[model samples]
Target chain A: MKTVYVCSNTVTGIYSAIYDAWKARKGEEECSVALRGAVETELFCEYVEVEETVHKAQAVEALICRHLGREAYWDIYHAVLAADTGKGDAILGAMLAAKTIPDSRRIMEHLSHPKVEKVFELSRSVIGEAHFLKGAVRFRELAGGVLYARISPKAQVLTCLAPHFADRLPLENWMIYDRVHRMFVIHEAKKRWILVQDEFLDPERLPDLTEEEKEYTKLWKGFVHAVSVESRENLKLQRQHLPLRFRPDMVEYM
Target chain B: MSSSESMTTYTYEGIPQYMPQGAGGLRPSMFQKLNILADAAKYDVACTSSGTARSNDGTGMGSCERSGICHSYSADGRCISLLKILFTNECIYDCKYCINRRSNDVIRTSFTPDEVCTLTIEFYRRNYIEGLFLSSGILRSPDYTMELIYAAIYKLRKEYNFQGYIHVKAIPGASKELIQKVGFLADRMSVNLELPTAESLKLLAPHKTRKNILTPMRLVQNRMAENKQELALYRNAPGFVPAGQSTQMIIGATPETDFQIMQVAQSLYQRFELKRVFYSAFIHVNEDSLLPARTDEGPPLLREHRLYQADWLLRYYHFRAEELLSEENPNFNVLFDPKCNWALKHLGQFPVEINRADYKMLLRVPGLGYKSAVRIVKARRVGTLDFSDLKKIGVVLKRAMYFITCNGKMLYPTKLEEDYIARNLLSAGEKLPGEVVNMGYHQLSLFDDVGFSGKMQQYM
Candidate 1:
């Protein structure tokens, strides 16, 4: 009979499930991980509820960093943040497969392994979305002088975008809200950034924009319209690159 | 026409404006100036913000990404990476193709250094642009125009502490000292080639000579080489054009073959050490007899697209221009891309075994991008990759199926003949350009030699 460790759909929850499954000392075929809501009950299978904790997640993170190396650990970390429910099981399977190999750190390069490939694909997708959101994230100046941006990314990408903007706008107070994930990445001027999760902020309730902000928005829209060549207009190609999903928040589109 | 009188009347939003028009001229507001300058600069076509990655240094309010970022895409589908604009539209040269020629009666205005700085910083703060792309028309002289541009960027860098990407144009015939000073402040610098050949330039732009343009390009190239050594010696040495330099040529303006244009691009990459060579399809903005006759056919966007595809091959795919086009075949095939056309022409190299082929060989496969080719090589080392695995690796197997064999087996029962494969690839839903598709397949047979027999044929 196979044993499935069930946990919530989060980095901490997934890592804690991996921790419990690892401590079971069962063979790779005997144990698996699944998200709490996404798990389908299998016949003659032992389902264990993982007691998720910060310490367990930290221990597993350190274990992977020490054994599988930082590069593989990074892929696993991003895979856990992916939207796919299979990501937790895939990551756990990849980790188990790594132990069988002579060199565990090179597990990501074993792309032919189905579990490892799943993790690689998931990590690539999460990073790809994060990279796109880095540029697509737009900041509007509020009446209070803080720069606020809202992005409804597919993955929980607030963590990835915060450091990039924090480095780019070190002197300016800025905050980015992930509407889909209901999280916030807040950074004060001349200070480090912090990620706040489970924040319920209504999308329609953003503060009023500054007078300068409105003027600049109008100017930016005009500039976008002016810069395009009238003869070479191709809405299909523009949609291909910019995509329709990111248009709602963009000032030029608005 | 005095500068003092124009300045007082052009005030807006408490910021003093600089107007270059004579008395009785309407003082265009900031909105109008941005519209005019941005519209004028749109034709230059080098808006990339890549090549340098610098953090904000904890003092400034900007940083650069090595891969660059697109803040927005215009309706024309061009990436809005930089706030591309002209410092002024006032010109002394009557270039035949230019909209802002000296003979033309256009609104002539200049952005003061402060105005340029404020726009860049404010726009950058809103994440509307990656940085600034400052080009200008000749105001009195090349040196004078270059000095005005230098003043704006110098303030943006030193006083405003803007650490963002800045791409500036090195004005042709500007003093070498002034050009050198501007190079230190810009991340990337370019001198427009204007036209592919000297004869076309002479006919189109009477004031710009090949020597005048290449001189400043050579100056930046030499300075960048020296800056590399200085940075090697002193870690914190101020760099000159750290993102390197690029140049652009106006295609279809003159009677230059695609082969001739590509040869010029190849030499620029090899000899001049240019980072990029942009090809702008000549749009008829001015009515000049010397220019190509205005037709219902818009800009030669398809041709420009092909050149860009070939340009990517030159830079990334380890391909030479000669491999892509020749005097016998001066233009790219309308039906297939450069790589697919090359593969079809040389079918003897077909059916490369995925399990045994090397990275370079995989890159030549019809539908294998560099990324997927790399992934195939890595993944195959761990396990054999079949057709399904290739699809999983992001290879467009619909096209690659005709060219590749996985584990000594083709994806489908297909002939190795070029005509058979080309027809199959066409039916595989390869999205042809709208112009080609709209022309209808029956008409395509008559137009098979589209580039070889059209207006471009006269040049050949």
Candidate 2:
């Protein structure tokens, strides 16, 4: 009978489930990982609930980094952060397939393997969305002078974008709220950034815009309008590059 | 006349004293100046913010990314990477095609150096722009305008500690000293090659000489060479135009052949080592005898797009200008892109074996991008890749299938004839330009006229 390890849908929970499956010495065909809420009941399968912990997650991270190498570890980390519920199984399969390969560090380059390919695809998409959000994330100055931005990215990209913004704006107090994940990346002036989860922001109690913010918004809108060539107006091409989904958060479109 | 009567009445004037008030005297607000200056600067097409990657030293407020970032797109579908605006619209030159020609009656305004700094910092902090793209009209002289640009960028870099990307225009006739000073503060510097040939420059822009423009370009090239050596000797020598220089020419303005324009661009890339060469389709901004006649047809955007396609071929695909175009075939085909057109003409090179072909040959395939070509080489090292693997590797098989062979077998039993492949490729849902799609297939000729297409009038 196949064994299924159930865990919450998160980086830590998935890694802990992987640790439990690995500790039981289960082969690729003998074990599978499933998310807690997205689990499907299977007949002739022994289901086990994983006791998630920070230590288990750290052990799994270190084990992958030590055996699969840093680059493959990076890919697996990004795959875990992806929105796909089957990412835990794909990651575990790739790890198990790595042991059969001549060099475990070259697992990512083994694109012919099904599980490795799935991990590669998921990592690429998560990285792609994070790269786009690095540019598309727009900040608005509130009345208190804190730079606040809101993004609704599919992946858990708050961790990926927080360091970039913190390094880019070191002296400014800034916070980015991921509306989809209900997570916040808060950074104080000249301080390290911290991630806060399970937080809710009331839309009605949003901060008021500063005077300078309104003035700059008007100037930016006018500039965006005037910079476009009158003879070569192509809204279709604009929509192709910047999709309508990202237009609501962008100030120029607003 | 009594002195008291003259002072009180002030009615003894043949021409009244020039009173510069209202629009001329009162300074335009920040909003008005940004609109006027950005509007005047819209004719310039280079808005790229790539080629420089720097991190904030924890002292400055901004950083640069290697691939660059597009904060937004304008209505014309161009990427808004930088806050592209002119320092001033005041000019002493009367170029025929310029909207801000000294003869044209348009509202002119200039921004102070401090205003430029404030706008850059505020916009960058809000993630509204990647950086500042500062160009200017000759306010009084080339050197004078260059000094103003230098002052603004210097203030932005030093006082404001702005470490973001800065692309500045090197005034054509400006002195070498001023250009060098400005280059040290900017990430990229460019001197506009307004026309492709000297004859066209003489016919259109009387004030600008080709020799005057090339002199600054050659100066920047030599200085960058020297800067490279200095940086090699000393690790922190304060780089000069680290992203290198780029230039733009007004396409369709001077009746230059596509072959001639591309040859010039190829030479610039090879000789001057430019980072990019932007081609602006000639928009009818002014109606002068020297310029093209104003018509209902809009800018020759399709022709411009074809030229850019050929430009990419030259840069990335290791293609030469003579290979893409010749004296006989002076322009690109409206039906096919430059690469596909090249491939169709050279059918003997087709059915390239995916497992045995070299990297350069893989790049010549129609649907194989540089990235996909690289993946094929890497993935083929592990195992023999079949058709399905190529599709998973992101190759557009609908187009590449006709050109490539997997394990000595074509994906489909396809004919090697040129006309057959062309017809099949067209039916495979290749997305052509809007104008080309609207016009029926029969209307396109093998060598279509690149300029003044009658089909473009409908776009108006």
Candidate 3:
């Protein structure tokens, strides 16, 4: 019987499912994994809904980090955050390839393998989205002097962007709210940042920019307008570098 | 030209307080000043926002990271909008290629230090820019202009606590003391080598000489070297141009060949320890007989592209100027890129066995980039890589097919003949950037076509 472990789309959920599937030892052929909410339930197949357990997830994470190395572990970790529903299965495929490949630690570098390539493709896309958000996400100084920025990224990239801002703006109280994921990473001034998932992120509740913030925004608009050469104005090229989707949140475009 | 008396001086008092009337007699608002200064600054192409990794100290608003972030790309596909503006467009020198030459009847403007600081801090806070790339026309004497630049950046760093990457130009003929003072505050600094050679400098920019440019570059390099030593000894010794310095050479404005340009770049890297040598394609903005005719064809952008390709080969690929071009063949083949052209010339190096070749040898193969080569080196250790495996490894089999062998066998039966490979390579459509191809002029004209119409009639 082919056992398909249906898991939640989160990294912890996928790792938990991977742990349970490995414990069953049905090997590569009999057992498979699928991310819940990502795929439709099949009619006749034996489906196992893997429960989320921290211990199980930690064990699987430790095993991958130890056996396949940190690079592959991070690749799988970031790929898991991808919006693709098939990412869970891709991780399973990659883990299987890692077990079988001779130099298992360097399995991620084996791009010729379909399993490894799938993980890289997902990771690249997720990382690429996070990189764009790093440059594109604009913050407004709220009335309380807290920096507030909202990003409606396609990928679940809030966690990925948190470390960058935390490192760069260590003393600033800032919150990077992800609209799609209904999650946020908030860092208090000189304190550690924490990621919280809450569905109460309403645009109407966002405070207006302070008077200083308003002045800066106007000054920025003036500079941006002046900087572009009239003769060499190429909107098509500009669109290619910074796509149209990112512009809606940009202060200059707004 | 080298005399101190020859230098023109424009003091702070010498600058006009308001907008000099032209182009709509509206009172020059701050916005209008920004527009004119920014428009004037656009011709400069070196707007890189990389090199420094200054972290925020909590009090300030920004941080500079190692890899540069491009905020926006211009219509030419060049990165722009980095708060790149001239401190002032008022000039003393009369360089023929310059839009703000002394002879030109353009609107003159200057940004006060306080205004420049506010613009940089504000734009940075909004995430509209990576950092500031501040350049200027010679407002007065080089010393006076350099002093104004120093005053502006001094406020941005010390007053505003703005820690973002700042790339400022070190005005040639500025006193060494002022350049050093500004050097400590800036992340990166540059001196423009307006024209490639001394003779070209003499012909166009009568006031500026080759010495005026090279002197500041050498000064920055020396200061950066000293700063490195001091940094090693004292942890908190403020880094002097921590990102190092770069210089720009205007291409196609002068009659220098690719060979000469590459040699200049090669020597600059070896001698000066410069971070980058920017190549600006000459856009004919002035109506001087000394300048090239401005046809709709625009600048020699294609030639500039080829030179940049060769430059990468020099920096990363371990190739030299002499190897890529000689006096006999000083220009790159317009049909093929530098790498492929080299591969064709040295056909004996072809059919490198994929598994057996070292990392360096693999890099020379057509269609194999540094990343793919590194991947190949890593992947081959696990198992024998076949042709299909090579495809999955991101190797462009289209070009690499002629150059590499898998498992002691060619992917297909192929000849090592140059013309055969060149024909195949040509048919594959060189896969250059679209802008490069769009800027290209046809080498053969339809007007010069003899029997091409006769051949067309056969199809008709």
Tens-digit per-residue lDDT, B1-460, candidate 1 = 4334554444343323344553487766778889999999999898899999999899998999999998888999899999999998878899998898988877777788888999999999889989999999987678777877888898899999999999999999999999999999999999999999999999999999999999999999999999999999999999899999999999888888887888899999999999999999988988988887787778888888888998888888888889888888888877678899889988898899999998888988888999999888788877888898888788988888889998798988889887787777777777787766665433433313336335322222
- Looking at every candidate separately, what fraction of the true A–B Cα contacts under 8 Å does it contain? 0.86, 0.83, 0.55
TM-score of chain B of 3: 0.89
Counted clashes in each candidate structure: 0, 0, 4
Greater-DockQ candidate between 1 and 2: 1
- Per-chain TM-score of chain A in candidate 3 equals 0.94
Per-residue lDDT for B1-460 in model 2, tens only? 1112221111112211111112634656788889999999988999998999999999889998899888888999999999999988878899999999889988877787779999999999999899999999986678877887888898899999999999999999999999999999999999999999999999888999998999999999999999999999999999999988999999988888999999999999999999999999899988788887665557878888999999999999999999888887888877778899899889999889999999999999999999999999998887899999998899999988889999999999999987788888877777878777766554644334454353234222
What does candidate 3's lDDT look like per residue over B1-460, in tens digits? 1213322334444432222333344446777788888888888878887887777777776787788777655555566537899988888999999999888988776777888998887677666788888999886589877888888888888898888888899999999998999999999999998888999999999999899899999999998888889989999999999888888888887778888899999988889998888897787788999876555655666577888888888888888889888887677666667888889999998789999899888988989988888888887887888988888778999999999899889988989998888877766775754443543354434432122233223212
User: Where is model 2 chain B poorest over a 10-residue stretch in terms of lDDT?
Assistant: B11-20
Give stretches of model 3 more than 4 Å off: A23-26, A40-44, A53-59, A100-104, A141-146, A209-222, A229-236, B1-27, B432-460
Instruction: Using DockQ, rank the candidates from best to worst.
Output: 1, 2, 3
lDDT of candidate 1 at residue B450, scale 0 to 100: 38
Alpha-carbon runs more than 4 Å astray in model 1: A202-206, B1-26, B355-358, B379-389, B406-414, B441-460
**Two-chain complex of model 3, DockQ on C-alpha atoms against the true structure:** 0.51
**Candidate 1 residue-wise lDDT at B442:** 38
Question: Which residue ranges in model 2 land beyond 4 Å of their true spot?
Answer: B1-24, B440-448, B451-460
**DockQ of all models, two decimals each:** 0.81, 0.80, 0.51
Query: On a 0 to 1 DockQ scale, where is model 2?
Result: 0.80
TM-score for candidate 3: 0.89
Model 3 steric clash pairs: A234-B75, B8-B141, B9-B141, B10-B140
